[model samples]
Structure formats: structure tokens, C-alpha cells
Target chain A: SAVISQKPSRDICQRGTSLTIQCQVDSQVTMMFWYRQQPGQSLTLIATANQGSEATYESGFVIDKFPISRPNLTFSTLTVSNMSPEDSSIYLCSVGDRGSDTQYFGPGTRLTVL
Target chain B: DQQVKQNSPSLSVQEGRISILNCDYTNSMFDYFLWYKKYPAEGPTFLISISSIKDKNEDGRFTVFLNKSAKHLSLHIVPSQPGDSAVYFCAATPGVGNEKLTFGTGTRLTIIP
Candidate 1:
């Protein structure tokens, strides 16, 4: 299992503000993913961050709204741009080893947009 | 529509007993199924997984049973402990290696001590 950590564990931001969440892994990993879990809802994939390449955004999501940076194998960041009240959700980053199918999740950043 | 569904929103069981959580999927493309446990203020942790080829997989106190025909799967925890109290989510992926996962609404399991 990978040890994953996210910075700014929780934050309350005003509407129209942006917040960037950072994810760090103990060891290098091949795939990093961003997910959002809204209140009383299931997890939804936001994007897949690849090292030194552009992130792959899932349908219903766009790059301008959620920009991602995967500069290396052990680190990545997801920024929620021009946030709104609807953006209040738990953001999580997960790391996957190329060897196995398992993906370990970070502690998650809880965002509250008011 | 949600491809994966965990109909029950919450369940409660006594300690030292068995805890069973059920999940169903509508997408036939989903080949891999997984269970994740989440605590408040924390991200979900992978608990167990079962492939379409196998009907059952076990690890220590946790066991996952799959019914491919029904597109249903279940996670069973024996001798449920208070520490087992958490929200359990069911996720499925069509293929392996960086494929997107579809998650179901979680079931909050509370183990009564």
C-alpha cells in the first residue's frame, strides 16, 4: 500500500475563489487520479494525471474548471478554479502502482465553498 | 444512472458477529469490483477486490463474494469489530490499469460494541 498525503486537509473558501490541493506519495507511482465526493454522493473521477503530460479529464469535467499538474511520479496537484458553492466536496487523490490493480487514497481535502 | 448501486444506506451489527454489505452493478463491462472503507475526515482505503473470473476472494477477516449472473457482489466481515465501523463503498472498472472507476453510494456500517 502507498502512503499518500494531501496538503491543506480542510479549508473554507468564499465563492469565486480557487483552491489548489496537493497530493504527495511516499514512493513513485505510475497513475494518479483525482476524485470528488459530494455530500451524500458517491465518488466521481475528476481526472487522471500523468507525469510530464496533460491530465485526462473525465466526461462532465473540463480542464479549465479543474486544472491538474503531475510534474513527477510522486507528486500531483488539483486546483479548483473559480469555485462556487456547488464545488464544496471532498477532494481525494489516489496512487496506483503499475504492478498491481490496487490504488491507495490520500487523506483527502475537505473543501467548503460559501 | 449509477452503474453500481448499494441500496442500503446504512447497516448496524453487534460486535463479534458477521457483517454483510451488498452491492449491485448494471454495467456488464465492469470486470473488476472493489470494496473501499472510509472513515470520517479520511479518504477511502481499499479493502478487497474480486475479478470477474473469480467468484470469491478473501483476506484475513474480510471476504468478497461475487455473483456474476446477478451482477451482484458482497463483502462479509466475520467477528465484526468496533473498528470496522465506517462507510464502505463499492467500485467497479471496465478494464485495468488507469481505467476510470464507477463508485456506488456508500453503506455506513456501524458495529455496536
Candidate 2:
């Protein structure tokens, strides 16, 4: 299991603002992913952050809205740009352990855009 | 379309009894299924997982049973405790290279003391 942490555990932001959430892992991981969860809804995959490469965004999500950066193996960031009320959701980062199918998650960042 | 589905919104079980949580998937391509437990204001913690090749996988008091033909799976927790009370989520992935996962709406389980 990996110990993952996210910054700005909860934040209140005004619409049109941007917030960048950081995820740091204890050890290097091959795959890092970002997910969004709405109230009383299932989690939706936002993107896959890969080191030294551009993140791959999922359908209904775009890079311009949810830009990601993975500078190193153990660190990644997801920025919610031009936030809106609809963008309010809990953002989570996860890493898949090498040689293991299990993925560990970070304490999610709860963002409320007013 | 929801690839993964947890039909039950909530479940209540007496302590020390078995608690079963069920999930179904519409996608036959999903090869890995996982269960996660979450508390309020916390990220989900991985509980257990089963591969497409296996029908049953057990760890401690938790067992995951998979029925590929029915595209269904279930998690059983025996001797349930009050501390086991939390929201359980079921997730599925197509395969290794396809890292994306489809998650089902969670089922909140309450264990009565």
C-alpha cells in the first residue's frame, strides 16, 4: 500500500478562479490517475497523469479545463481551470502499485466553487 | 450508460452477521473488479479485488465472489463489526493498459450494535 497525500484538503473558491491540487506519494509509481466524485454519485475518471508526458483526459473532460502535470514519479498536480459551480466536487488522486493490481488513493480535495 | 451498478443504496445488518454487497457490470470487457471502503470526508481504501480468471477471492473475513457469466459480483463480510460501517464502492477496469475505471454508486452499510 502507498501513503498518498493531497494538498488543500478543502477549499472554497469563487467562480472563474483556478485551483491546483497536488498529490504526493511515498514511493514511485507507474500510473497516477485523477478522479472526480459528485455528491451521491459514482466517481468519474478525469485523467491519467504520466511522468514526462501530457496527461490523458477522459471523455467529457478536456485538458483546457482540467490541466495536469506530472513532473516526477512520485508527484503530480491537477488544476481545475476557470472553475464554475458545476465543477464543485471531490478530487482524488490514485496510484497503482507496481506488480500489483490494487490502487491506493489519496485523501481527496473537496472543492466548492461559489 | 453506467458500466458498473450497485442497485442498493443502503443496507443495514446486525453486528456479527454476514453483510453482502452486490454489484453488476454491463461491460464484459472488464477484467479486474475491486471493492473499496470509505468514511465521511476520507478517500476510499482498497478492500479486495478479484481477477477475471477467478470466481472467489478471500482475505481475512472478507470474501469477493465473481460470476462472469452473470456479469455480477458480491462482497461478503462475515462477523461484521460496528467499525465496519461505511460506504462501500465497487469498481471495474477493462485491463492493465486500460487504467480507467468505472465505479458504481456506493452502498452505505450500517452495522447495528
Candidate 3:
């Protein structure tokens, strides 16, 4: 299991503002992903952050709206741009195990857009 | 459409009893299934997983049973304890390695002492 952490555990932002959440891992990992959990909904994949390359965004998620950065194997960041009330959700980052299909998630960042 | 589904939103069981959480998936491509436990204000922790090739996988008190024909899988916790109370999410992926996971709506399991 990977020890993952996210900064700004919870935040309340005004509509139209952008918020960037940072994720850090204890050890280097090959696969890092971003996910979102809306209120009363399941976790949805936002994108896969590739090291030193552009991320692979899932359908319904775009780069401009949710920009992701994976500068290295142990760190990544996800930014929600031009936020709206609908953007209020828990943002999580997960690290995929190289040896298995398991993914370990980070303590999520709870966002509230008002 | 949701590829994975957990019909029950919540379930309660008495301590020392068996707790079963069920999940169903529509996508036949999914070959790997996993169960994750999540608590409020925390990240989801991996509980157990079962590959399509295997019908059952067990880890101590946690057991996962898979029925490929029905596209259904369930997690059974024996002798449920209060600490077992949490939201359980079932996730599936088409294959291995870096594949995106499709998660089902979680089932909130409450173990009454």
C-alpha cells in the first residue's frame, strides 16, 4: 500500500474561483490518477496523470476544466478551473500498484463551491 | 449508464453476524473486481479482490464471491464488528495494470453492537 496525502483537506470557494489540490506520495509510483466524488454519487475518474507527459482525460472531463500535472512519479496536482457550484465534490488521487491491480487512494480534498 | 451498480444504499447487521454487500456489473469486459472500504473524511482502503478466473477469494474475515454468469460479486464479512462499519464500494476494471476502475454506488454498512 502506498501512503498518499492531499493538501487543503477541505475548502470553501466562491463560484468562478479556481482551486488546485496537491497530492504527494511516500514513494515513487508509475501510475497516478485523479478522481471526483460528487455528493450522493460514486467515484468518477477524472484523468490519468502521466509522468512528464500530458494526462489522459476521461470522457466528460476536459483539460481546460480540470488541468492535471504529474511532474514526477511521486507528486501530482489537479486544478479545477473556473469553478461553479456543481464543482463541489471530493477530489481524490490514487496510486496504482505496479505489482497488482490494486490502487491506493489519498485522503480526499473536500471542496465546496458556493 | 452505470457500468457497475450496488442496489442497496445502506445495510445494518448485528455484531457477530454475517454482513453481505452485493454488486452487479453490466459490462462484460470487466475482468477484475475489487472491494474498497471508506470512512468519512478518509480515503478508500482496499479490502479484497477477485479475478474473473476465480469464483471466490478469501482474506481472513473478508471473503469475496464472484459469479461470472450473473455478473455479480459479493463481499461477506463474518462475525461483523463495529469497526467494520463503513461505506463499501465495488469496483471493476476491464483488465490489469493501470486500467481505469469503474466504481459502483457504495453501500453503507452499519454493524450494530
Candidate 4:
């Protein structure tokens, strides 16, 4: 199993503000993904970040609201812009080893907007 | 509409007993299914997975049963332990090499000692 970590484990921000959450993995991986788990809801993918390419946003999520940066295989960042109360959720980062179906996840960053 | 569904919101089981979690999917295209366990403030950890071709997969006390024709799958934890208390999520992907998944609303499981 890969060891994954996220920065700023929890944060409280104000409305109309943006917060950036960083994810780091101990090992290099080809595919990294951002997922949001809203209150009482299932995990929803925000985007897929691959090094040296534009992140692919999932349906109902957009680049403007959740811009992702994948600078290398071991790191990525997700910025939640102009956040509202509804944006309060647990953000998670996951890494998938090439040719494997399993995705390993980092301890999530819990965010709250007031 | 959710492609994957876990109709139960919560389940309680006694330790040393069996804990069964059920899940259903509406998408016929899904070929791989997985179960993940999540603790509070922690990301989901992969539990067990069953490929569509197999009807069952087991590891230790955890076993996953898949009924492809019914679009249903289940996770059975035999001799459940207190540590097994957590939110369990069921997810599915379309096919090989595609890791993208559709997840079901999690079921909170509590194991009473």
C-alpha cells in the first residue's frame, strides 16, 4: 500500500474565499484524483490529475470551481474557489498505480465555509 | 439518479457475528466492483473487490459476493470485530484500465461488543 498525506487536515474559511489543499504520496503514481464527500453523501470525483497535462474534471464539477494542479507524480493540489457553505466537505486525494485497479487514498482534508 | 445504491443508511451487529452489507447498481456497463471502509475524518480504505466474472471473492473474514444478473453485490464480514465499525461504501467501474468509479451512499456499520 502507498502512503498518502494531505496538508491542512482541517480548515474553516469564509464565504467567497478560496482554499488550497495539497496532497502528497510517498511513491510515484501515474493517476491522481480529487474526490469530495459532502455531508451525508457519497464520494464524488472532482477531477483526475495527470502530470504534464490538464486535469480532467468530472461531470457537475468544473475547472473554475475546483482547479487542480499536478506538477509531478507524487504531488497535486486542489483549490476550492469562491466557496460557499455547500462547499464544506471532506476532500480526498487518491493515487492509482499504473495497470492496477485499486486506488489508495490519503487521509482527507475537512473544510468548512461559513 | 445514483448509478450505485446502498439503500440502508446504517446497520448494527454484535461482535463475533456476521455483518452483511448490500449494494445494488443500475449500470449494466460496470465490470468491476469494490468495497471501501472509511473512518471519521479519514479517507476510504479499499476493503475487498470482486470482478464481474467471479461470483465471489474472499480474504480472511471478509468475503464479497457478486450477482451480476441481479446487479447486486454484498460484503460479508464473518465473526465481525469492533474495529469493523465504520462507513462502508460500494463502488463500481466500467471496465479494465478505467479507474473512475461511481460510489454508493455509505452505510454506517456499528459493531457492538
Q: What are the iRMS values of all candidates?
A: 1.3, 2.2, 1.3, 1.4
Q: What tens digits encode model 1's per-residue C-alpha lDDT throughout A1-114?
A: 889999989999999999999999999898899999999999999999989999999999999999999999999999999999999999999989665877889999999999
| C-alpha lDDT values of all predictions | 0.94, 0.94, 0.96, 0.94
Docking class of 2: medium
Instruction: Order the candidate numbers by DockQ, best to worst.
Output: 3, 1, 4, 2
Question: How accurate locally is residue B5 in candidate 4, as Cα lDDT from 0 to 100?
Answer: 99
Q: Report the C-alpha lDDT of model 4 over A11-41, residue by residue, as the tens digit.
A: 9999999999999999889889999999999
* DockQ (model 1, Cα): 0.73
With a 3 Å backbone cut-off (N, CA, C), the pairs that clash in candidate 2 are: none
How do the residues A1-111 of candidate 3 rate in per-residue lDDT, one tens digit apiece? 789999989999999999999999999999999999999999999999999999999999999999999999999999999999999999999998665779999999999
lDDT of each residue in B18-41, candidate 3, tens digit only: 999999999999999999999999
Best prediction by DockQ: 3
Q: What overall lDDT, based on C-alpha atoms, would model 3 receive against the true structure?
A: 0.96
Better of 1 and 3 by DockQ: 3
Q: What is the lDDT of residue A4 in candidate 3?
A: 96
Q: Which ten residues in a row have the lowest lDDT in candidate 3 chain B?
A: B92-101
Task: Note the DockQ of each predicted structure.
Answer: 0.73, 0.61, 0.77, 0.69
Clash pairs (backbone) in predicted model 1: none
Candidate 2 share of real interface contacts: 0.55
In model 2 chain A, where is the ten-residue run with the lowest total lDDT? Answer: A96-105
Which 10 residues in a row give candidate 1 chain A its minimum summed lDDT?
A: A95-104
Q: How many residue pairs clash in each candidate?
A: 0, 0, 0, 0
Model 2, residue B70: distance off in Å is 0.4
Q: Which segments of model 1 are wrong by more than 4 Å?
A: none
